[model samples]
Each structure stands twice: as structure tokens, then as C-alpha cells.
Target: MATVEVDQDLCVGDQICASMEPEIYEMRDDGLAYVVDGMEEIDDDDLIAAAKDAADACPVDAIIVEE
Candidate 1:
């Protein structure tokens, strides 16, 4: 399992994370990306892959994954 973390300070509200991994990452009212439960339910490999991909693609490099 992977825990997703987003750095609000660096996030640019790009929505890339939400597009890449809807189940794992979401856009809050603040217009920033935040993980769902930090995406604790994302145990499937595909979902994890998408989440990781989103993290890697974040322009601000604000996502952090912990296994």
C-alpha cells in the first residue's frame, strides 16, 4: 500500500493529480490537490500506478508517496 501526500505550499492547483488518479487524489475547495484518506484504499496496482504517475507528473513536485 502507498500513502499519498501533497505539499500544499508547492501545489499549483493544476488538477493533474485528480485527472491521473481520481480515486486517490482529489481537488479540494481550496483548489489544491489532496489525497483521499491519503488514498488508503488504493491497494490495487493499477490505481497505485496511476497515483504514482500523477505524483511524478505534478509540475510542482508536491506529491510524496510512502509505501
Candidate 2:
């Protein structure tokens, strides 16, 4: 499984992660990116890949994925 996290301090609210993976990420009213509830740890390969992609797409590299 992969553990995913979004660092609010590093997030620039670009929403790239949210755009790339809406099921796992969202941009809140605070202008920061966050991982949706219950999606912190991912076991599905497809979702893991999507999360990795979202992490890579983050301009500020706020997203972290640990396998």
C-alpha cells in the first residue's frame, strides 16, 4: 500500500492534484490542496499510480506518496 499526504504549508493552491485526481484530492476554500478523507492510504494499484501522478504534477511538491 501507499501512504499519501498533502503538506498544507507547501501547497500553493494550484489545484493540479485535484484536477489530476479528484477522487483522492481536493482544493479547499483556504486555497490549499488536501487528500480526501479515507484516502490517506491506498492499496489499489490504479489509485496509487494516480496519486503518484498527482504528486508529480504539484507545482510546489506538496504531495507525498510513500509505498
Candidate 3:
């Protein structure tokens, strides 16, 4: 399984990650970041790809995945 995480300190409030992985990424009201995937863990390769694309698209480079 793969896991996605965001470093709020580095998030910069960008929504690119959200756009890239709407199933997993969202922005906080305070302009930080959060995982809204509605789950506590990642389960497969497709989820990992979506998370990776979101990470790659984030200008601030805040998203990360553990596989």
C-alpha cells in the first residue's frame, strides 16, 4: 500500500494537489492542507499514482507518499 502526506509548513495553500487528486487532497480553511480521501490509508498503485501526480504538480512540493 501507498500513503500520501502533506507538509503543512510547505503547502503554500496551493490547490494543485487537490485538483490532481481530488480523492485525497484538500485545503484547510486556514490555507493549510489536509487529506480528504475519506480514508486513513492508501490501498493500491492507482492511488499512489494519483497522489504522486498531485505531489509533482504541487509548486511547493508538499505532498509525499510511502510505498
Candidate 4:
């Protein structure tokens, strides 16, 4: 399984991760991006790929995706 997380301390509210991978990431009211509820652990290959893409797209490198 692949796991994804956004480091709140490193998040810059850029929204790139959320935009690139809405299924795994979301922008909260605080303007920071977070991993959507129940989506931290991913089993689908497509979702895992998207998470990796989002991580690479994050300007602050706040998104962490691990297999």
C-alpha cells in the first residue's frame, strides 16, 4: 500500500497538490492542504501515481508519498 501525507509545517497553501490529486489531497479552511480523510492509505495504482505526481508538483515538498 502507498501512504500519503502533507506536512502542515511545510505546507505553503499553494494548492498545487490539491489541484493535481483531489482524490488524495484537499485544501482546508485554514488554506493549508491535507490528505483527505480515509485516503492516507492508498491501494489503487492510479491513486498512488497521482499522489507521487502531486508530491513532485508541491513547490514546498510538503506532500509525502511512501510505498
Q: Candidate 2, residues 1-67: lDDT per residue as tens digits? A: 9999999999888888998899999988898888999999999999999999988888888899999
lDDT of 3 by residue, 5-47 (tens): 8899888886787777778888779987788855337887787
Q: How close to the true structure is residue 56 of candidate 1, measured as C-alpha lDDT?
A: 88
Question: What Cα-based lDDT does every candidate model obtain?
Answer: 0.83, 0.93, 0.78, 0.92
lDDT for each residue of candidate 4 in 1-67, tens digit (9 for 90 to 100): 9988899999999899888778789999999999999999999998999899999999888888999
Indicate the TM-score of model 1: 0.83
Residue 55 of model 2: what lDDT?
89
Name the candidate, 2 or 4, with the larger lDDT value: 2
Backbone-clash count (model 3): 0
Error in Å for residue 64 of model 1:
0.6
After superposition, the stretches of candidate 3 with alpha carbons farther than 4 Å from their true spots are: 37-40
lDDT of candidate model 4 versus the reference: 0.92
Screening candidate 1 with a backbone cut-off below 3 angstroms (N, C-alpha, C), the clashing residue pairs are 36-39
Q: Write the per-residue lDDT of candidate 1 for residues 1-67, one digit (tens) a residue.
A: 7777889999999898898778888899999988887475456788778878988899989998767
Candidate 4, position 31, lDDT: 97
Candidate 3 matches the true fold with a TM-score of 0.85
Cα error of candidate 2 at position 65, Å: 0.2
Q: Count of backbone clashes for each model?
A: 1, 0, 0, 0
Q: Please, what is the TM-score per model?
A: 0.83, 0.96, 0.85, 0.96
Residue 61 of candidate 2: its Cα lDDT? 86
For candidate 3, list the clashing residue pairs, or say none: none
